[model samples]
Structure formats: structure tokens, C-alpha cells
Target: MTTSFPMNAGDGLYSYSKNSHLQKEIIDGAKEMMRDVIIRKLDIKTILSSSNTLHITELGCSVGPNTFSSMQHIVEALKDKYLYQDQVIDSTKSTIPEFQIFFNDQVTNDFNTLFRSLPVDRFYYASGVPGSFHGRLFPSRSIHFAHCSTAIHWLSKIPKELLDKNSPAWNKGLIDYAGASNVEIVNAYVAQFERDMEMFFNARAEEIVPGGMMVLVTPISGYIRLLRFFGSSLMDMVNEGKLDEFLVDSFNLPLYLPSPQDMTKVVEKNGLFSIERMELINIKSNLVDEVDAKTLMMSLRSAIEGVIINHFGSKIAEEACARTILKSKEISEWMKVNYEKASILFVALKRK
Candidate 1:
């Protein structure tokens, strides 16, 4: 059963992209979980057919530093794997394996900063390809391995009710908890997600070699877990105003939090991949700590200053945001008094 919520939470109201430092920490955790897959199933040896050469691609890759770190780790891991087999590590970096890495995302992503963040000798090749990962980006079986972290859940773009004459099907059902049955809108979101994911796999089907491996780590949940956790009190609190206006801001931002089973079905229907490893991890988020939250909150220039303004007028939203922070004193008190934590990670993979 799909448990639905009132569409009152602010959506597309913030840019969650600037928190690269916090994102790096999450990536580190993901790397630990996925390292084995990269080595064994999606091993460069299988894709490259040579011990000394490999190709890597990071999709929806944001800044280059974290992307660079991940690639370096993969390269090192592979080098270590081959060391025992080859009896000696290559001295000449160029001779060991020419690691060609492509860090791709939207063309508008901060490529300049990403480039500056990279070290002198990081990638053999670095280029920006601007397009949705759901569509074609690279040639058939051109890249050895692909990895994407914390980025796939994004809808190509948020559905816009710009005209305001007749709202979208999804938005039609968006209502308060008192009137919480937006089946049309909810179904639309789910349908779009399914289609987009299918397209994503189809594109990957063409790009990933027959034996290539891919890992997709996103914020996900079992439908039961979602309805259980969110339905229990998350919605009630919002209805009661305990969470304020943007209460759903952090809780339900994912496009659709699919279960492990849900994802397995998605892969199965696609017919081009196989599930090798799957795990539900409690990932720390781009919001580092209490202090980090403040920075992240402030870093949301548009959320703080723009979206809120458009939604509820600038003056009122600003006042509300400020008051929300002041009222959150209880949240801080509760954190110290009680050990309250939230699980923020979901991981999955497909190997051909």
C-alpha cells in the first residue's frame, strides 16, 4: 500500500547541491559498502580484459574532489588486486593502468570549481556531458564501470504549475492532511519515476559492457517503512504544527523511496542487469552536524530568500524561518536529553 502525505511540504524549494563536504562523508560510507562489488563483480579485470588499464565513470557527479577521491580509491583498490596476481606493482603510473575517468552531470554543474578542486595528475580524461542520466550519454559498452551516489532520485525537473490555470495531475491531489487523498498526483509521481528509471537502465544497457557493473545509491525506503515511519507521527506532527510549515522539508524529499524489493523488480523488468548486492544503510547526510545544519540552512539562499518568498511572501517566510530556528531550542534540548537518530542511507547495485 502506498501511504500518501499532504503535499504541503516545500518541494523544489531548496538547492541541496552545495553541501559537497557533507556529501563527501556520505560518499565515503558508500564507498566502504560498495568497494567489494567494484573489485569482484564489476572488477576492472573483467571489463578491461587487461590488468594494467581501466575506465571509470561517475554519473550525476557534482564537484570533482569527491569524484576524484572515489576514482583514486577504485584505482588503488584495483592496483592492489592485481599486485598479488602480477607479482609486482607497476612503477610508471602511465604503464600500470591508464585510468580514464569521466565525471558527468548537468552542464550547468560547477565544472570550473570541480576542475580547480582536482589535483595536477588526477584523471587521464575529464569531460562534461550535459544530459539526463535516464537518456543516452555515452557510446555502447564504452565505459568499464559506472557509479552514482545520492543523485538518481531527482526527477528530471520538478513538475511546474507555472501557469496556475490548471495544476498538474500530481499537484491536483496535493492537499492538507485533513483532505489527504491525492491519488492522481501520487500515481503520476510514481509512474514518472518508473518510466525514468526504465529509461535510465535502457541507456545503461547500451553503455555498460555485457559484464560491466553499476552501483546506484540513493535515499530509499520500503513502502512499508515509509508509510510506517512517516505515517505514524511524522504527518500527525505536521498537522498539529509541531513541525512548522516546512516540516516535510527533510523527511520526504526523495522522489519515491522504493524498497529493496521494489528496486529488484525495477531491475528485473529492465532485463539488462542482475542484482549482486543490496543493503539498507543508515547514511549520514549532507547536513554534517548541528553546526553543519546551520550552515546548510543558511547556504540555502533560494530556500531562505526566494522559494519561501514566492510561496508565502518574503516578509512572512523570513519571519517564520527565523522563528522556527528560535523555537527549535526544544529540538536541541531533546537531542541532548534523548538519543534520537535517523537513518539516511539506502544502497543497491546491478552487475551484468
Candidate 2:
């Protein structure tokens, strides 16, 4: 098939790779949206009422270079908030202006790599926090704003089904994205996301100060065909049977994306916050440039990590990654639909 972005890099710094041209575009797009969201909601006067000591946290913060652009945008917005508040400053602002940042993610997260890239001279205080954000990572009522981008979907590590014998969601009679038909499997994964989100907010409610804000940009479900087309196409490969052996031996497996409404319910049910703004930005799967093959690989990897190994076999996993990248080359033709054009950006505030 034909592709534009590079899809060849496997074991290298993706952010520095040339194939990341389109990936860069996507990240930049996210950064821009973040800036817009901050300006639209974050009440500077209220936040900097007294102390500039607003504490911020970013979950799933990858390497510093990966999120550097977005973080810069966030800081700029806060500064603007400060400026706006300063103009109207009376003797009564309650919040302090000192900003301490918490950068959190799984322990295996490349904290050293990310920390190495941080701007040493930056004004804010940043510290690496290792752990799952869904759990209690921050002290109660200690955080002002908490953000997680493209990360929460990782549900408490993989389910034990892959290792246990009695689990219905595990291997055997009912094959998940790892075996053949994954409608049941993907749905189960999505179900977990619903719970993860619910817990995220409930825990966040305790961590975030009242009136604090949060913004998250993640892969949201809206495309109905994506789950079916991709899910079943792998099923077709399984029917051929070459794919199954590869999948079973692979180190990982695929997961699911929950719908927008489903996510909203989780947030509302938890009662920690209210959705302030939700924007759906569409991305044509084809628009993912080939030049950033690793970037694209990582993007798809997060969603379909072990599926290819199950369907195509480990022997061809690398090539499958190539083919996987090329497979999207015909994204326009895959479902004869607009392939992957819509994405979501959510902004909310902690309810008092």
C-alpha cells in the first residue's frame, strides 16, 4: 500500500524521528486545543486569589520532549491568568502564586528520560511522581489542577485473564482481541475504562482543591466502525490461523476506547466535577503521516499492542507493524468511510 509518513522506525527516540512529521502535527494540535480550553475556562482571578502556589499535575506524562510543547502552553495560560488577576489586584486574593508541578505516570515510566529534557531554568517547581494516576498518587486536596492526556485508557495494567484459567475474559473458549472475535473482549476493556474513570474522578475529587480545573485530551469513542472494522479484520486473519500463534506468544494485547457519553456518565456519576467543554476533532487515519512511523506505531500500539502478535504471529510482528502502518494506507477504503477524523478534548472544574 501507499503511505506518506515514515513507518519504519522501531527502536529509537520517536520524537526525534523524521517520521514524526504528522505526529508532530497531532501533538501541536493537542497543544493548541489545550491553550484554547485553558483560556476559555480557568478562572485566574479565582485561582490566584491569594497564593500563586497552584499545584498542577500531569498524568501519563511521557518523555519531557513528548509533552514539552503542551506544558509550555499550560504555563503560558497560567501566566496570562496571573496577569489578568494582577491588573485587578486588590489586597484580597486568597490563593498564592507559587506553582508546584507534579508529573506522574507508572513507575516504569521513563522519568529520567523525561526529566533530562525539562528546561532547567523554568520558573515552576516540577517533581516526578511514579505510580498509576487512577490510584491515590497525590495527597488529598493538595492539587489545584490535574491533567492526563492519552493515558488513562491503560486500565490497571492488563487483566489477569491473560494469566489465569477461570476468567471468562481470559484465553480459551472466548478469545479476546488476542484470539479472534473481540467484540466481547473490547467491550470488556471499555467497561474497565468506565470504572477507571469513575475511580479517577472520585480520587481526584479528594486530591483536587474545590474550584480547581482539569483538562484531558484522549482518544474517545465515536467512530462506530473502527471497533468493528479493525476488530473483525483481525478476526479474518485469525480465521486464516497464521495470526493466532503470533498473538499468543506476544508480550501484550489490545484494549478498547469508551464512548463520549459513557465517559460523561462516569464523570457525572462520580460527582467530582462537571464537563465544561467537550470538542470532537476528527482525524483521518490516513492523515497519520508515514514519516513518523514510530509515532504512528506508538499510537496504534497503545490500542492494539498485542492484537497483531495474536493475529499475525510474533515472527511477523515487526513486519506486521509495517503492514499495520500500511494497512491504514487504505484507511479511506477500509470502511469506505472517513477513517479516524474525530478526537475529543475535555475541560472540567472540581465542583465546590
Candidate 3:
């Protein structure tokens, strides 16, 4: 039930910050959606005027830089809203409502490093909340704005049925269900997603005040086919006796890229939130033409290394990573031509 594997830490060699190119794209996509809702539709002026304090929480905030970037945007947006009508408001004098911001992720997230890298003169009072977003992490009606980017696609854990050898849904020799071609495996993934997303929405509903907004940005189903192809190459290694088939068979990433329709259903079914805006934002992969395989591999490793190390141990994890890096050129070549088609969904909802 835990989903807290964090990116490797430290500057110049971290899992996420090292892959700044991809993370920046994710931030830009999320920002575009926020502009449409937070800057335009949400009654921030009214909300600020009525409350003495505002609450904000970011889910799945990996260590440093981008997390700070997201917080800055959210804080500034609120500040700008307050200044629109109250021109005399002085931020230094505390004229606007104070902010209470919480950074949340799984229990094992790198909180020490995240805290050390905090912005020096931040306006909000910041704290860390460690828990899986699949369940509630805050008190009822406590939060005003909630944001999660490139994170929800990760499920709490791999579907249990997929691990059962006798089960029809057993996903042998595959790291992800994306483009699985098998009906049972695909159905098992869909069913698991539905359950996890329901928990996410319901939990957020309890914590977010009515009329509050939550923006979720995540890579959709498009990356699956490409990933499945790259994964096949790893299997080829096992086939040729370069690697163990047991390692490949026992590994299954706990990620499910939901379609837009699937997300809509969960939001409606939860009944505590209303969908305000939902659209796919295409993200062109720069790694294709640039041949930046290291960045690509680091990005992938950050997200899944914890799972790999947990299941196969560090030595095997290192070997698997080495093989992945060795074969990255093939993926890079395909991605260059098809990168522009990669898209992420930006969904804005209002707690109701």
C-alpha cells in the first residue's frame, strides 16, 4: 500500500533534478492548466478575502527545484489575486492571508534533502506530510488548493492478480501493462486503476474545502506503446541468456496511465468534486534529436529504481540499469521521430 520510492538524492547526480529537461516540460504543462483555472476561473479574490489563511498541498513532490517552482507559482497566483483589488496590500507587512503549505509524498521520500533545499525567502509556512495519496493525508475541509503532477499514474502497488502465476491476469515478462495486447492483463490494470483513483478522489474530497480546486497533471496512455517496445529489448536479453528471465518475469511496475474517459468517470463517481477543465497537453521529447540517452534513462530510473532494488536487490538493479542504458540508443532513435506525439493530461476539478 506504500508508493513512496523517491528519486535518488544530491546535486549533479540526483534522479529527478538530473533530468531537468523532462521535469521542466511537466511543470510547463501543469502551469498552462493552472493559468486557465487558478488565474482565470477560481474566485481567488473572494476566497482570500473571506479566509484569514490559505492552505495548499503538493502531492508527489520529488526533492527540490521543480517542487519549489510549483509552490512559487501557487503562492504568487494567490498574492496576485489579493493585490488586484486591494492595491494597498503590503506583502512584507502581512496584508494578505498567510499561507499554510504542505509537501506530501510516500513515507520514504527524501524529506531531509527537500527541507534543506527550501527557498530562502518563501512566503508560506511549509511542512512535509508523508503518506500515500491513495488515502487521505489531511484533516477534513482543511486544504484550499491541491496539486499533483506526473504522479497519479503511479498506483499504490502492482496489481496483485498480475503476480499470481495461476491468475489469467498474470503479467509475465512485462514491466508495465501498457500495450499488453492481452485482454485479461489489460482488464486487470483497468480495474486496479479504477479502485486507486476512487480512493484518491474520495480522500481529496474530504480534505479539500468545498469549491476548492485540485489540478492533476500526468502522462497519459501514449507512452505505453513506446515503453513496451523498449521493454521487449530487455526481454530479448533474457532470451539470449545475457540476463535471468526470473528477474524480468517478477518485475512489474505499479503504474497505470488512465485515459481521459477513465479519469472523468472517477471524478463523477466520487461526487465530491466537479471537473472544470480536462485536456491532453502534448510534450515533445527533446531526447530524440539530441540523443540525450543519459537524461532519459535517469528519468526512467528515478521513477522505478526503488521498485527494482526492492524486488531484485541493488546488484541486479545496477546490472539491469546498465543494460537499459546500453540499449538506450534504439529508444532514442524511435523517440526522436515520435516524441512530439507524447501527451499529458491536465485535469482541473472543484471540490463540491
Alpha-carbon RMSD of each model: 7.8, 6.6, 2.8
lDDT (Cα, tens digit) per residue for candidate 1, span 1-352: 1111111112233333343444465578777767676556554445667444466778877653567777777667666655533443444333356667777776546566666667787646666665568788999778667888766655553333311325444232122111225464455556656777898899988888777777777655321121222223333445666644343322222255455666777788888888787777664444434564444333323222333344446454555455444433443443333212333344445546
In candidate 2, stretches whose alpha carbon ends up further than 4 angstroms from where it belongs are: 1-27, 30-33, 48-50, 91-96, 157-187, 222-254, 283-295, 298-319, 326-328, 331-337
lDDT by residue (tens digit), candidate 3, 1-352: 5656667666656366565566667787677567657866677655544677889999988786888888898888877765554564444553677888999988888888889889899999999999889998999988889999878988777788888888887777888887566789888888888999888998998998877889998888866655564367558778889778877876777788888998998888778888899998876556664357656666777667777788778776777676776766776776767667888888999887
Model 1 regions lying over 4 Å from their true place: 1-18, 50-52, 84-95, 121-124, 159-184, 221-254, 284-292, 295-341, 344-351
Using lDDT as the measure, name the better of candidate 1 and candidate 3: 3
lDDT of candidates 1 onward, in order:
0.54, 0.57, 0.78
**What value does the lDDT take at residue 326 in candidate 2?**
54
Q: Which residue pairs collide, candidate 3? A: none
Sorted by lDDT (best first), the order is 3, 2, 1
1 against 3, candidate with superior TM-score? 3
Q: The CA-based lDDT of model 1 is what?
A: 0.54
What is candidate 2's lDDT per residue for 304-328, written digit by digit as tens?
Answer: 4344454455555554444455555
Collision count for each candidate, in order: 4, 41, 0
Give the poorly placed runs of model 3, Cα more than 4 Å off.
12-14, 45-50, 85-94, 240-242
State the lDDT at 280 in candidate 1: 70
